[model samples]
Target: MMLLDSIGSVFSVIALKPIIMLMFFVIFLASIGKSIGVRRMYVNMLVRIFEYGRQNIESVRKLQYSNLNSSDVDEVALTTKELSTDSIDQSSNSAKINNVTKLNGVVTQMVNGDTNNGNSVISRVESLILLPGVENCPSKNRDSNQQDEIETLEFNLSNCLDYVKSGMEAIIEDEVTSRFEAEELKNWNLLTRTNRHYEFISLRLTVIWVIGFFIRYVILMPCRVFICFVGVVNCVVGFAIVGLIPNKKLRIMANDYVFKHTFRIFCRSLSAVIRFHSREYKPKNCGFCVANHTTPIDVAILSTDHSYSLIGQRHGGFLGILQRALARASPHIWFERAEAKDRMAVARRLKEHVSDPTNPPILIFPEGTCINNTSVMQFKKGSFEVGGVIYPVAIKYDARFGDAFWNSSRFSMLQYLYMMMTSWAIVCDVWYLPPMTRNEDESAIDFANRVKSVIAKQGGLVDLVWDGQLKRMKPKKEWKEKQQEEFTKRLKGE
Candidate 1:
């Protein structure tokens, strides 16, 4: 009896009491629809910690550089010279001739300088003199020499230099592959692997990291997990009950209420701080709501304010349960893998969904895959083809708080949630732009690209023409062939 009493006391102190208190706190916040400045305070503290860490790192780096000697500097200079000499030696004779020709042209241009009209007068004069002589030459020998030169079609090694530069750029960092990876941060966010070796820069920083680890894993993780569990349970049970209602109006009301509050609970689980701008342009009535894709949590973040009918492929496991629950109360379109691939069928369904006056605006990520929040990839034309108002929303996350990007190819859903719950916070801004409609003369692809540019501009993200699907698939044969054709045109001076 004494031992049992001791175990009960320990359990109540460590787990039971905190769980009950946290549950009540979360419920109170959800009911009131306001936060009590806790998140703000936490963010301020993080800012101070990050500043301190930055200063310490700078000091350490300065100290290290101060300790470096003259010998090391001389050695680095000598090594650079040797590398340059080696490169020069390895070049072929043709490449050397090409380089010499380029050097000579550059020197000549510099010596002649530019005209007051900002044109290269010498170059123009030389071209005119050469052209007339070729066209109006009377000598048979000169004409024969010119004909031979034209027929030879001498291959300049310099022509292929552009390919070398492009190859080197790809080897260093290509645009498509980098968009699917994590966004690089300018400062460490107290998360592991977010930055390189910042935690070990100073003993003080290391101690702070240890404390943050305890706070995240020991305290915050448990509270977040519990809140998330409650939210999921509420979603499943609430939607199931709402589905049984016979009245469509009441059912929609109940569904909206449940969805908004439940997703608000989810936002709390990640301690997400979302600032929405231009709420006047928020989606209303049935239309297409398009946004840049960053992560799966974008749904929860947006749903916290407005109830949207989600569109996606049928998922299983945890996502499957949520999808099944959502479908019960709302009209969400979940397609089979084969059906999703049928563009005609997908477009038909989208048109049908928007045609109805009663349906909520369908939220679609037209990029069709998650980008790293640093850029917006090509938007698929299916949604734009359905013919409706396009409500473009731009979502940009602050990486100093947390990395909200979901690299689905690298991490599973569960693994992503683990990182989110452990993160300091998920901070982001959402901009709801004015509704756009396709012009009568504009094609579906053109309209889609237009909306994509709007969102990318609003979010300050790089607007890329590359498909996000390139993360998994190779470049299309047609795309490669088109590039080859362009290169040939350049070679022929066409």
Candidate 2:
């Protein structure tokens, strides 16, 4: 009663924050109560911690345990040893470091869990074996066992860690040496590297574009507009005098010469957009190449990168310039949509093109249809019909460009072209799969499946089933299921 009365008197003397001070005392007491509850939580929490520690320690033990068991403490001392005298590769070293980092997480979890597990296990065991405050430190350990056991364990662990660290460093150095072997001069990975580097340099290009735009509007456009007006007047005057002079042939020649020169300049400029690359593959060649069908920009990407003659619909565009230029290039085997049902005629035409020895390799985007680049659409089997060898190519836009939101919408060709020209920094992958020879008995769908499998494996590029049409990037399980379903349907047709 006297102690309680004294505490109450002290509380009354306190000022504005009395409730806050009282709450703090309550929380402190609650924490003490929770500590009492920890024994109850130990079974589950300790199990998790133990699992983590076991995983971390397993790597160390497997790699270095023998060294530790030998009790060669000097051999176990990792710090005393130096890395390999042979110069190691930086990249391989980095990769090993990454692997080491993965181990770090396992180690941290191991240590944390081990500590927690140890505390929990010790607490539980102590309760069963000895009373906390008065328990005698096993009479033997009080003299030497405890100290020696701890030192031994520490030494074992240090050597184990050192061995793992050294092994990892060696792995990294070896990997760097392998990747940059200068012997294979064929820059097969040149495409991927260019895409990565292009991303870095794009900001500079954008700045130039922004500045060039201002310059174009301020200086070039007005002059071009005036030039167009003058050219129109001259043409009008020539047209007015045409009939009496009977000079139609001269006018035709003049027009032809002007357009020819203009075309050469345009092709040169487009080629410059992508640095010089030659992607000429023969249809008879034993390789496969796949493509994404979006806007005609997809065609330009192929032409600029690989120079493969494209096989597609005979569609005309502005000035008929693209159509004319591409037509002159061999392997531009075009067929109208109406010709699909006329299988014999279409196959015959394709066969002729493929038979030509002089013609460059034919490239096809079997999608036969364009979709929002957000997903890969189901492929059309037209290209599969001419099958000799197939190489699956996947071109996904890297994130440097806001890809998810940026494909051209609906039928807006102009906007689509503009968007592509400005922001389509793409990562193009060309995976050359071993050729699949035509089986006289194999149906087209089977061939398509073989092609699809080749592509899906390229980078797990698969169709997603959204609302109705198959959308791309559907989860792998679902994509595989859809593929199975498609296979069944095709078999039924066969």
Candidate 3:
């Protein structure tokens, strides 16, 4: 009994020591805003492994294809021989037709016995043959007019076909639906998110996958969970302390400090590697900082570098706890669902927030919903209408590392966080663009679009005009009506 007790005690000490040490190490790094290149080294090693796996997979695939090609070659030769025979037969038929045409000058003339009659016969035959790129030469003015009418009908039909093709494409892969899903990676990163089933491709890959699974689930997840717990506790405690301070200026300063450091700790929990560019244009006091939304983590990602007052609909559960914690320390605006839907009230709150210079810049994702990192969708005009200096920030994630988009409808916050913790790392680049303000003549919607275009251009993302809210609701009736109007115009040759 004594030996067992001693052994268990030793094992607990060995396990707890490293965990405690890692907690301190992470906290220290977060406080200093420094990285020791551990994540970079891990990423470099992963790159090498991915490259090695890709090369081996290619070699195996080539060997497989080569074997297939050997059998395919004989089948292809046989098919080619048969095709040649059919082509010869077709050529002979054409030759016979050409000979008859030369003898009679026109094939229809041989059957009709008069040139005028042959013209009518040819027209009738052409009407029966509805082949593309085939045209009948008309001898009379009336026949020519009829031919022109037929061509006009075809042109109109082709215009409608264009709409059909686009509709089909949308049905298969619509912009809104795709934006709500994970962005596809060009290469497999040894993650099971891909449809390639790359793990089973080779024995080496299988072994690597098993090892990676152990590292991600057994080693990294527990550490990340522990760090996340520490971060939350620190945030709650830090905010509670900050709330106790009575002096406004000192409280603001304390709040900013606590927010930035707490978020940095949260960032480290996910092993996030964020690179900020053009820091000179970061959001200032009493300004509206607009960004493209990809995930709920965007707040943490941005807060790691600069503190901003968040504005959004009040959420519940884990998100609610964090929201309440943040609200206690700062002047964050959280609207109930009913209040959020009142644009005038929401704008009023925003205007009040920005009017106060003491408040931090109000961080707003005018998109209102998360989009896959591939594109910037339509920006709501409410924030732009609030009349404040807009600081546009563009955030682009490296999906090769891990996808950061949050599909709230499909996965809950906890599920999304689990996936994030297990991912290799959240690597992204953030660009802070110059400050923008609405032009005197520019409407709020136009100003919003202008800002969105700038962010999309900076981030190398597609600029789209579709509302992000389409993820939850169907497109507005006005949009469908506009499309119908355009289709009618096209049909009328306008």
Per lDDT, the best of the predicted structures is 3
Q: Show the lowest summed lDDT stretch of 10 residues, model 2.
A: 125-134
**Off by more than 4 A, model 1:** 1-4, 7-15, 70-157, 338-342
TM per candidate: 0.82, 0.38, 0.84
> Candidate 3: which pairs clash?
none
Candidate 3 residue-wise lDDT at 386 = 78
User: TM-score of the candidate numbered 3?
Assistant: 0.84
61: Cα error in model 3, Å: 1.1
Clashes of 2: 10
Give the Cα lDDT of each candidate: 0.79, 0.41, 0.80
TM-score of model 2 relative to the true fold?
0.38
How well does candidate 3 score on lDDT at residue 468?
Answer: 82
Q: Ten residues in a row with the worst lDDT in model 1? A: 124-133
* Tens digit per residue, CA lDDT, model 3, 277-305: 99999999999999999999999999999
Off by over 4 Å in 3: 77-159, 338-341
lDDT of 2: 0.41
